[model samples]
Target: MQTADALQLLLTPDDDAEPVLIDGLSIGAAARADTTDRKKDVTLEHFWDETGDPDDLEEQRWGVIAPEGAAGDRLIALIQPLIDARREAQGGHEVMIDRVPSAMSPEEAARWRKQHFDVSVELARDLPRYQLILGDLNEVPLALQQHQATDGFVGRLCFREERAYEAYVDKVLRWERARAEAAGGARFFTVHDRTAATTIGYRSLVQPAVAQLGRYKLDVADLGDQDEPSPDAFLEAVKRREPTVLFSISHGAGAPRGGWKTEGDQRDRQGAMSFGRDKLSGGDLGDAPFLPGGIWFMLACYGAGTPDVSAYWHWLERLKQSGHFGGQTQSVLAGLPQGDQRPFIARLPQTVLANPNGPLAVMGHVDLAWTYSFQERDTGRAMSRPSKFVEVVRATLETSRVGSSFRELLKASIVTNVELTSLYDDAERLGATPDPARLGHLWMLRQDLSGYVLLGDPAVRLPAMRRRLKKDAASAGEPGVRVHEVRAQAPLPAVGPAVAAERQAEDAPKLPPDMDIDDVERAIGKLLSGSPIKAVASEHDIEPKQLSALKEIYRKAGRAALGVK
Candidate 1:
């Protein structure tokens, strides 16, 4: 069976069977290794050198031990069973590993890693269906550096001291030996890439999206260097590139007031140089190129905000209206804190590229307040980007599936753990529950409601209910009959005087058929001596205007026909 089909079956399990087990170095395990009381000697400063820079110190700390409560633990717990079940159903395969000896001295660590890597490559040569994932137990690269590692091999060796190096070597040897013996049909390889703020940020936001979908594949490309390919270059390099959904993370901005004659605002620009027009106009956006047959996501802030100036809607609005993009495009996620763009940008690509459907939905905050948060108490969640990213993405995706529209999905997906309160809750506390009718009306006015749907409780099943109402309308030959269910309790009983008053009013004498306007007026004056205008209007089936007109007619003419007044 295909991987997608296998994964789906695994996710939606049968009633009778037990869930499958997924084994890996969980984020939680990594955290525990990093934080045990046994690591007291590993000071925050020990990882640094005479330069007194904390960068290297932080990297060494993370490399040695994982943080407490890493969000990756929760994610792995959620998806491991599904992966295991899928593998089991697909005629279970074994994973092979080449164990590297850690009993060797510090000088031999590199050689040990190289030997294992060669062995893993040899084993992988025969299996075309199998994929390899590799990791270096020692010499953590700068990109992977969470805080900062020492300056060089000499720094790291000195930092490790005497017993530290031996202990690490022993740990690596044991881990590799155990993995190699547990030989499966597949071979496990490790590749190390440095982590940047942007990549880390993107990972956090995309995790929720991935877990929410339950069954999907992800292809991650780290865009860390400014010197690397620009967004346009990456867009052009897509080969066999018929993706149904596309998402991008970059700096964005709005146009200035004086057309192209002035420098445009730097508010939302995602690092791309802007120079076409002096003031930057929507006209430039209209001319901007876009990919065909894919939805786009702009993780940058203010990219999709209202079009006060020409540049506001030129990019986002044009992309949606252009008919080339599939479902939706532009910045659906919120911006980063204090105008930092890394986290939001990191998640956009992860979310869009993972789903073959090409991002039918994009969920994110519009402001920096929502996108920025710390992973651990110290060293800034900003520094350990991926862990934070994984948390946000997972939360967003879970929320997105529960609602129909991006906003609703975002509101639903708003992650509110015991530790973190959601922005939606804050808005609610401030009394900002937007009128659902008004929201629907606005969407209708925009005429972009086809791809957009409200994200809310699935139990409501409004669309199905609406369809039933439509069917009833069609069958009854009534074009506009609306059928809906609303819960209401019986009203309270009327008070004693109110009840008596209602009875008296009901039993009052009827008006004379031959009475003129003057006679009727006299009767009303006598009956309603101190009653208010509201009571008079309620008693008669006429409006205030009709009552006034009758009163005027009575004053002008005598009661000649009835002869009472």
Candidate 2:
């Protein structure tokens, strides 16, 4: 058994984190030890100072990592039983962790990750189709030397306290039991703006899927208008619908160190979803329900952690297309080498798992995410169906472990980028012109793979997908057609002939189909704030019912968005 002292010392992280020093060992500054309260204190040491909270646990893993050769083998021997115990409990799913052999140059590190990611990507090639991924996202030197962090690669996010992991597992088991008893099937909700080009590209490609793809009913809450996209709408939807799977897309809210309130600072909003003028910070979720057996995909920047600055350099070209260098300058500044100084703000995905009522697992980009990740070429033409991430995640929903799917998707993305790069170079050498779009996408794919991180139990399987909603031949001809299942009933709105006519007229308007609901609500707010509603509505061509829906949304959560009592 690992002693409290050994646990404390082994998990203790250095005050200053740099890439591997010449000697390979990080010179850590020692500090006070409290073996309890792992949730608040779990850290990589960069976020806290020695004089800070005295009860914080060192951010390092208690006993998972080990150097290559005999030492690593020994550590694995000790840890293998613990992991085996978990794998055994899961039955069908397996998570295999390999120690990173040694420290090397950044280039070598890239190769190292690529090699592992490549290995992970090959699920079902000769193995099971339900494969997932497992990673070691510990800090440098430690990660380089085969050590673990508070958060393991199995996708259980970060468990900060001594019993956090145990509690998380217990919750997962509870979720499994509930899933076994529940009558409903997998209910999924995805929220995103349709008007944004990136959003359109993503939704157009990812949303429409084979009806029988998974044992889940997919529901979407389109942002209708950015201003009208209320956080309440999402929360209410979750509360009402009780979606087992939730996917969100938007800009993440994060500012430099000083931009946040003391103790309740920017880290609170690091992976927060931007909703019109308002946002859903991790702190806001204190009142949210926990999705114990659920999986969340946060399609936003830094929803995980900011990866090595190199991850964002690929966007410079995309910025150059804006005909301004200011954005390019920021990209350059952001990507500038701040050696050994890794800027990692705590992320939202982990927060979701950390929540008492939060979900079982949340996967997201560690840094900025881009469109190229999901876009891939089949026979050399760009197409969006079956994105690497989507394929892996969907597989997990069916039969694989959370970590396996994440790892496999990550590997496929990385390998695809490498292949594209080689193809580009080959075309150039052969005196042939390479497609510029293909070249651009190559960078995005590579960057995306590097940042993709899953925070939750690697072994946690998505609730068994139940085919309860079979297609009705009379109303729907298809076999796997979707029909809403009644759970908790809500009162229907009072409707009259006049209201029916009004709704018909509203439905007939030429409104922007892609406008987000939140944006619509925001527009209504501006109107309430004394912007001529009739004139503005006419000019913008808003339909009557659409306009009414916006107002109704305001009624639901207007005061909060407007920032008043």
Candidate 3:
């Protein structure tokens, strides 16, 4: 059998550049799992149907979430103008902007999510369907945001200055009041053949998605290749600002071959995109007009931001322990940031978002992006899974709000998680070893889908072309002009208002406030060891039902779901 490096050499055209699949994980790691027919059949299209009527403004409630207490209060005050504008836009609909429990890390975020959103019995559903987070990864934490986004529309805005927020709100209001020029045009830019990630993304995902978009009659521009892969050309395209949607495929700047000169340098440049030899950073943008009144889907690693830690950290460590791709593992590990530094929203996105002339929202990967997101090979055959990517483009082109479009992309995580759970259950039931390869594939799928997030207000959408403009064009006998249509979404199953209250009265246990998972497990262990129920309940200050619930959680999803790992 060929070595992993040798296989990569066989597949990749450029010897100097590693294949994205290899960069993401070694061939040996990929070889661990194969021919999972279950995962192969799972497709994103099955969950593409949106719930609730698209035309109903009432169905689209909007809210802003931030950190709890002083920090959140200050941040909210800074962005109050934007919040007020959004609330006014909602008209009669109630818009509540609230703060989440204080959480500075993913684990803390998980705890807060469990206490609120993940409860088995939801007592109140007061918040809106669309939520815009109001801080960076440090303030609110990406884990909490990602969890909320699983079934709801979510976006984030992080700015260092109050003036930036003021500028952004003014920009949003201006754009909302008037239609953007050539709003129906969608542009695709790619540094083609540069790396495996870019090459496959353009050919497999971008091409197919564009072909699908042709049915909507949106003007499409496909540009970027070795000859035209300069930052100047890309900047010029953005300066034109004609397209309401811009899609690009390239490498997000990672740790250099020699490593970053300083931690500050890494924070600023880690997520920048390389155009030939030139790099595009927020500093490079410098308050310039970039995708004004538009949306951007940047397909690159850390294009959105870096998490406090990579979700794949543990999995990569496991692969490394398996004794293959020693050097390759370290190369990837260098990018899988641990506790060495603080997580941050990418500088490029932050700068553009705060600009007066900038995109309304950006959809991109928050962690190390890989070809695993769009291409699957675990079923023993290479298959393209571009529906998630296509769904975002399709929704945006159809005049859906950027938040709703982002939710469409995230729906794949639900599909992937369900399959992952099923795989876990089967292994447990049969008392058989779980297939490592199958687990790896499902894990990657879930992480890849979960990594995508929105950076901006969820309420923002591509502006509708003015009615007068449309009428004038019609009088000129403009043929084949595409009109935006509001397609019906299947309504979510109706829930009785009293049903949740009743369920909470019965099954909902009053868990001790902010109890960590390890503590819960210790209590469970004592109970299993034949300790008195009343004694355990009293000792933990939790209801007996709470203990039962915690045990079930442990049995099913393990302690990780509860809190600290």
The TM-score leader among the candidates is 3
Candidate 2: where are CA atoms >4 Å away? 1-84, 90-156, 176-179, 183-227, 240-243, 256-266, 314-328, 331-341, 375-383, 386-393, 411-415, 421-437, 465-565
lDDT of predicted model 3: 0.66
For candidate 2, report its TM-score.
0.54
Task: Identify the superior model by TM-score, candidate 1 or candidate 2.
Answer: 2
What is candidate 2's lDDT per residue for 498-531, written digit by digit as tens?
4544454455444355454443654575456555
Q: What tens digits encode model 1's per-residue C-alpha lDDT throughout 331-441?
A: 221112223212112222222222232222232222211122322211211222223333233222222111221222222112212112222245458877433332222
Report the lDDT tens digits of candidate 3 across residue range 1-565: 3322221210121112343344434544754433343343322112112554332233455677888888788878877777666554444446676678635454565566556543443323444667889877878878778766766688898887767777777888777656455555688888654555566677678887776565554677787755657887788788766537889888777766666667777777777876644678887777677888888999887888888777766666665677754545445545445565768888888888888788888888888776777776557545788878877876786556788777777777787778777876787799887667667666766777788899888877777531111123332333444456689999766455344444543554544554644446756766666666655554344578878777665443433333333
Q: Weakest 10 consecutive residues, lDDT, candidate 3?
A: 6-15
RMSD of 1: 31.9
The lDDT ranking, best first, is 3, 2, 1
